[model samples]
Target: MKPTEQIESTLDHVNMYSTPSDLKITDIRFTDIYGAPMHCSLMKIYTNSELVGFGEVRDAASKTYALMVKDRILGENPCNIDKIFRRIKQFGWHGRQSGGVCGIEVALWDIAGKAYGIPVYQMLGGKFRDKIRMYCDTDIDPHLSGVEAGQRVKQRLEKGYTLVKFDLGIGLLADVEGALCAPLGFLDQMKAYPPEVLFHSRATDEASRALRNKVYDLHNIAHPFTGIRITEKGLDYLEQYAAEVRSAVGYHVPLAIDHIGHIGVEDCIKLAQRLDKYTFAWLEDLVPWQYTDQYVHISRACQTPICTGEDIYLKENFLPLLQSRGVSVIHPDILTCGGILECKKIGDLAQDYEVAMAIHMAESPIACMAAVHTAAATENFLALEFHSEDVPWWSDLVCGLPHPIVQQGYIAVPDTPGLGIKALNDDVIAEHIHPGIPGQWEATEAWNNEWSHDRLWS
Candidate 1:
């Protein structure tokens, strides 16, 4: 339980990496493939040895996010995972940008697992559960008729998801009076954005407000600044949708709600209190997790459980929230939040505070496998997220997985080495590459030469 145990492991732990301390990272390259919700990227770290390791960056992020760390990790022993993580952890930050370090960490662990002939969970510690319980997520059209909503609940029930989440955003109030200030004020900024982001932007006008509207750049937006207020009338309208969904799903299942929009803490608290009758699994990301005080206020004010941390990076950043009991549950995205061991570390820390840990995942199979390993090892883990249950090709993204990747709402913890995925189906990836993005993975030789001194502390 000491910090040394996490960063430094004993020889008795797994004994897989002991034999291959000589394997060094020869090259690191990535492939971009389209996935549910957004385009996803992954790291393919080639070592001096033939055993390769694969890791995924969070969905909707750039592949270059991981490639930026190539200079730091090159020539390092891939098997010395924690030591390599320490050398490059300085390059990581608190959001999706941290994907670089996370991708590298997962890959290093994978390589070590393969080199040492063990599974990742064995290296982490030992398993707590044989299978990880998955919570399924899907979007809703608030305008659906009663019959339609009921039909949806029945369909999802047939699919065998025990825990469910629906998008509970301001869009539910679109046709109501004075419900939304500007519904489509910002439209798909992912396409309109420039090549690079600035530390300071001069877009204080009413027009350059997509970030304020919470339509884009979700990684950086602070919720309080949005000034998006919901009137009591709007609240009542939103509550109608909640009541309908709750009635359909019933209390027996853990029906969670999320994406309430960029509103102030006061509105968030009011809504949480108002919706207390429904008894949600958790109300997620009322704002970013950085506002620990507001989170504590919301946590104390409501009967419904509060959840956050899909955008948080490492265990150190989550400690403040855990110490303050700011939220009842810590939800981390596996690819964005420092991969397998780091998430296990966060889960362990949360256990100390009696806060439950659930993962926030929306990527290809590679990242989900990593999450499965972490969730399997963490005793206090509640659920791992499933965002692409509706995407038809999601399972085919990776080959050699058991058919029906998730069976009856649970994923069997794979017993094979590394993440247990045999390989990415190159043809499936080829079919799904987003337009204008590079379609090939082998052309990243140029990235190997792209280097700079990015060390932050002197």
Candidate 2:
């Protein structure tokens, strides 16, 4: 073939939507959505080509995390995702701190996908599955009994969810006498406070600062350090709860449990032993993700599978748990665990150690779709979490996908360009915009000039 003919053929197939080589990032802006059950900050990275990529900060995380690094990425090509990710990743740390870096990385991928005219999963070396399995996370009223909880699980099953999770911890025993034995004032401090009081207590006044510090001190106490113990009577009640839930849901489906409270490892082991007969999918976050030794201890003590890692940040930090064979399942929240590619890498690494991977997602559709892409590309994938099944407007926040994203407990991997979202539903979003966060994707010129020497070494 002649060179001229080859050039002409290439031109025929050129993407009219984007000039990948010339796609420079113009700005980064955010809109916070409330009552997706939690406040989720949705990020949009605009490009010179007029294409916008969607990403999301972890639920309840501040948008400032993403805004702080805007200057570092301006004028850079969004297609160079890895190079850009390396530049900003240093700014991210574990937990919600990583939300900024992770969210931006996902947006970059979204742009790259649009530029290349393919789905994000295709760019991640193609997909391993056509549809991503979803696990419904149902949090019933804590005052409800185990039987009621089981009924909730039954509802999820009726909706076609093969895998389901529920909250099963000391929170259930909060009102029950003789259920929990803790240090003086600990239970009182942990009790739920009114929303107005809790919000006002975050003020900068001296009194508010002292009160906030006191609450933090109590909450930050490591699991083992807390002198909370569950008595035999408490154990019996919890066991009965599990029994009723299991009986209602039946043994055919996989049932997972979470939020077992801030109790120590001994209590976790006792509860795990007691509930082993019901055969739970896994006992999640028994202690904390940072306590690799505690997870190892719990895994060894119980027949039930142990799981953790939603609060974990990068894949490197997961090394301790993976190396020690601490947990049977590694649950990475896409937003917290360094976004789409990083979660896929975590899943790949977990597969090396024969560990299953279930994602922990409780954010907007932006983050949900990011997890869906990551799950589609990962080989050790289990199920992605669906936390907003009850939120009627949850799936309406974005367009270009099915009205009900989770059809029969699974989301079909989208083949459309970018994160499969054509555009954000401004009307639906307007209705749910977080009243406290003042603007809706307003111009962020202030962040454009905020500069710092980001280098870590001399």
Candidate 3:
């Protein structure tokens, strides 16, 4: 073929199929992935070109977060991701409220990488490590026998996991009566709902059944609100629970603890003191991450390392915690921590304070892989979480990998373009869409229009 004909043929193909460069934010659609009970929706940005960028909303947040950003980036080039992020970043708020902006950011990076033909990490300044270490979020079965707990520990060690986390909350004492204080009316409110109720804790059947008999917002009810206190007997039983698990799992491995219910700093100090013998990797979210002083108190009071930050948004928000040395370790869920670049910034900020960082992940492989990229790029990263270790199909959600989704407790960062996924298998994804939502990737015509009085200052 002549050069002129070849050039014509290329131009014809560009018109025939939307070229990656001609892309604009033409459409966005979403659906939930049900395994973890997360509102796992995807934001797909359509361009004038053939390519589409995919991003996942953090779990348990509404799809509206992503939908609201549609008006801001509708005609913008996704390749200019930093500019696009700045335009929409103001809309993001603290915690889950920032889900939409964060989700859109992930999709933008996805689109930008696909357009430039590179990996997301390279966009953020290459990587620090070839593979990222991981900690499997395992729970000790309060109902399991001592032998069973030991077996579970052995299983993790055999599987090559160097780090593991477990719950050390009032939920463990749910089966033990007179442990968790509650209002009589609230206790009655809990009795009204059975284990199958929508408000139940999905973490465990034991926690569900145990907490079901407690007050309102069983696990989330704050200590200040409930005025719950552990009696001497209650404290004894709680320590016993910790001791049994520690005896089984042993102290050599890095054992982290979380979901400690909503107990305040004082009681948190006591609980951390009781379990200090076990040397937890960190005592996580003993109270919410918002209270900087409380974190400083908890950090000083407890011999065990203090940690939080799963719901924290952006690096700027994380500054107070790091600057104050509120906690010894920083944990940020990448989904809400300002996507890849912002999360890397959070880690870098923590590094200056000599604080280590960890990633909290609960979404599907899309978000996990995104976390993997950020984790690989950060130096102080301790471990990225694998929240759905029990679900075999979770890894099957995406394809085109050089290795298994995880190997020997580390995920090898792939050297592929655009999040390193060749293509997501649509048929496989359709099979696993959240059961509560009937529509799978349906057209998002309802959110096509936007409304706002969005502005910060003149």
Encode model 3's per-residue lDDT on 231-346: one tens digit a residue.
Answer: 56667776887777778777788888887865656778888889898777998888777888888888888788888898888788888888888888899987788787889889
- How much does candidate 3 score in TM-score? 0.88
Candidates in order, TM-scores: namely 0.87, 0.95, 0.88
Q: Mark the regions of model 3 whose C-alpha exceeds 4 Å error after superposition.
A: 1-22, 145-147, 185-220
**Tens digit per residue, CA lDDT, model 2, 280-381:** 999999998999998899999989999999999889999899999899999999888888889989999999999999999998889999999999999999
RMSD of 2: 2.3
lDDT tens readout by residue for model 1, 3-95: 777755654444443358678888877777665546677668888777789887777676667777787788888888888888777777777
| lDDT scores in order | 0.79, 0.88, 0.76
Clashes of each: 1, 0, 5
Clashes of 3: 5
Candidate order (lDDT): 2, 1, 3
